[model samples]
Target: MVTRDRCRGALLGLAVGDAMGAPTEGMTPEAIHAAHGRVEGFLHTQASGTDDTEYAVLCAQGLLAHGRRLTSNDVAAVWTRAVLSQDGGFHGAGFSEMGAIANLRAGVAPPVSGNDNHESWSDGAAMRVAPIGVLCAGDPVEAARLAREDAQVSHAADGIYGAQAIAAAVARALVTDDHTEVIAAGLAAVPEDTWTARLLRQALDVASHAAGMAEAERELYRRIPLFHYPWPDSAPEAVALAFGLFAAAEGAFVPSVVSAVNIGRDSDTIAAMAGAMAGALHGETAIPRAWRTKVRQVSGVCVTATAGTDLVDLADALYEASQGNEEYENAT
Candidate 1:
């Protein structure tokens, strides 16, 4: 059931939002409306991606190019190089980018932190995190573990939790074919203490009547309380976006992603996360054909809309990886 198309579908679904939302990443809901008007077109597609999904592709490209596997060292290298130029897919630098650049400059991978846990909760990790999820394949624990590594490369705390949630959800997609289960699995990944967790809790309470993204967005804004964060949602829009993605389950990929983007704070990253998750859940056909076709043609350097490697590839690889890993462990 996990076709090659679906493999790529998951990441591409994430990328569709990433590339489309790149231009609008930082703008507020009102600002987005004032500038873009109605927030309809592929407004974010004209340029490259921001830090979220771009870094995700970088890791994927690196893993694929270097061989079908990645070590922490390989991750550091790709992330290091990703920041040096736009090729890495980072739109702008964040804590992860800084650590990556620092490590590369030091001619080594960054040291893993210990003892005190870092508390950064940016959406960057969530934005660019689908590859980890796709590769996790039916294993939420492994997905969360991989997501944590991917998040800490720059983000900490909530960042790690967000990526874990998304990754676990994507990984779980390979197990059951149900959409509800997919959403449930994603929610289960994050803990109760974190912002992502709190947001999911709020969304779950309201998901039944929240109906369309518009109503869901308002409810989410009120509950998640983005006003408290210095950089808008500081938690980024991951929570609202996730809410919209779940609420907009009946809609197409573009609509789902757009809902996530327009719901306000962290629009781009939220859209990217939603897009990635929805894309994986629905597969390539889930995306709007016209939008995808346009994106493929308009893509900058690293991004691709179709005919590129995707989550399906990642999924199959994960299955193979699981077999190999199991064999290796048994041998040892």
Candidate 2:
């Protein structure tokens, strides 16, 4: 079972990583270096998370509302009620989610809502699955199932598989300290022949064999072919890179998140995913106090109505819900 500290760490680490990486999201590694010269700490004066943390909170809300019985209809309904109906439009939200919302407004239902007819292989699904991993705890298979179902409202194919892989890794992390087991569980979440599976396997191999952090990062990024992809939002590539960072860090929270951030493109989301996995494995106590203190409730610049929502309390509520505790029965 996931301890309270781990649960808190999972969400807190996500927010911290997101906030830390937000300032460099779309920049290339060279651009990042030229601008900030290696992001060892927060770059923005008013740092906060973007769509990643907010969407994860939304996922937690949906899970709390329906428990293990959560479905595509449930996700779609929540999205329609909370997201599509919100003011300000879905700014900062990725193309996949934005496309899904457009479909929802057109009276489309899910998984059709998710099948937006565009390239549905973005990191959008993977970005929001840590809550499912928290709820499923030690059961990687259950985590993968719920992640796939949740993802069905916004992703498909490799996109869904990417979310599954992250969720499975988090689930394993919650119960054990062994990163190899975590990596294996991640691989087991999807079929072997999938693009996501291939990338994940390659990343794991690279992380295991590489001499050090720099070598692992270089080899893993090379395998992902980040420059070849028009956008670095490719789900397989993002998830694999996040996993490789976690492996290279050997489950240390800061190192994993920092590597993900400094590696560049789609930096925030990749770091967020890797942070969640490491945080789950190491527990909240393992996270640096300075970074934890720096993280705050979001202002909804991206996810409008979710502004000021307390991430720590929300995480606790999810953890409570996972254990069948009813303190938050009336909460989000």
Worst 10 residues of 2 by lDDT: 221-230
Q: What is the TM-score of each candidate against the true structure?
A: 0.78, 0.96
Cα lDDT tens digits for candidate 2, 85-152: 78766667898988888888899888887776375789999998998888888999999999988998
Compute the lDDT for candidate 2: 0.85
- Candidate 2 regions exceeding 4 Å error are none
lDDT score of residue 83 within candidate 2: 89
Q: Local error of candidate 1 at 274, Å?
A: 0.3
| Poorest lDDT segment (10 consecutive residues) of candidate 1 | 298-307
Off by over 4 Å in 1: 44-47, 62-71, 81-91, 103-119, 233-237, 248-252, 297-332
Local distance difference test, each candidate: 0.60, 0.85
